[model samples]
Target: MKKISFIGMTLLFIACTPIRNTNIKTNLLDNNTFELSEISTDATYGTEKNPIQVGGVASNEGPKNERRFLNALAGPNGEAVTYFRAGSCCPIKSKNDPFGSGSVMLDNYRVTWQGAKDTVSIYINMYDSGTLKAPKGFTIKK
Candidate 1:
């Protein structure tokens, strides 16, 4: 009985221990830049092809929810879009047309996550006539 109780306690302790935190590599390559390549970009919406900036967390995720990575997209025409509270572990299941700040012309602009076949790669579709920029800590999907 004592041995069984000791084993139970040991199991509980192990379970309670925090696992090693997974982080998005801030410096993806040899360069210490958090920027990721744009998976796809289209200038067909307008004559201007907006520029994109990227970044992400080096480490940190929470229980029941992963750390949020913010992707900011901005255009030269004073338009900007931000993907807020984006989940790292799970793909967004549905499409959403989130409104942007007044400076951006992204009303009813649709965003869809096509699901990730690879954890290292994120698959997303966005209709942003504006530019995309990420925080000092996040990056766009390469």
Candidate 2:
């Protein structure tokens, strides 16, 4: 009887237990924010469906050229545009600058959802001259 009761209690405990939330981090930026600009939930470093995420766009100069599309890490997305610089220009004119000589950079993005309510931060070690990081990672909820 004692053995049977212990087994039943163990099973009950297992059944009532909840799955623990997991945290994952990845190297988002290596070189050239443009390389990171092409980022998408479908093409992250390792797993395709990481709950946290970030990304956006910036023009070489002038007003932001690309639209913004942001989302959470679990599902919602974030940021949509990027910018890059070109060697043809010098001192880099902010206005009336030719985009041909410039490039788009997409770096700096983050997502928060469910167990993740804090802000997400993207780190870039090094890159070319033309690249813009996202302002801030988006917030998400479960």
Candidate 3:
């Protein structure tokens, strides 16, 4: 019936609307990709002690935002960067917890570039948004 079709169209419209046009808060290459523009000189910025907070998880878009951030980085001297999810660890309290559990776990990504002797771990928090920056020894892609 037309009533059912109207309801379906309404849902579709709502689904396509962005949860938060946070592209203004953080540079974006696309709806799902983050374009990093800064570098963190602080040694602990991306370490286990202080993870990169990419957020968007409360909107069910955390994992995608995480990859977008990683994809926007290069090596310290502008070499192509590659990374993988090492695992999730270090649960911490957050106001953006999607589950209302008051805590969200951090995701660890091991990153490296050619000629690098060893991979470095980058800690990321997908549950809370922050001004994203490349970790020390990494560079932002142009």
Better of 1 and 3 by TM-score: 3
lDDT of 3 by residue, 6-84 (tens): 9999999999986743333677887756888779889999886788888777678789988999988899899998899
Clashing pairs in 3: none
Reference-based TM-score of each model: 0.22, 0.21, 0.79
Cα error, residue 134 of model 2, in Å, equals 17
Q: Is candidate 1 or candidate 3 better by lDDT?
A: 3
Q: Ten consecutive residues with minimal summed lDDT in candidate 2? A: 63-72
In model 1, where do residues sit more than 4 Å from their true spots? Answer: 16-18, 22-30, 36-142
Better candidate number, 1 or 2, judged by TM-score: 1
TM-score of 2: 0.21
Candidate 2 vs candidate 3: the lDDT winner is 3
Model 2 spans with C-alpha error above 4 angstroms:
1-41, 45-68, 71-98, 117-142
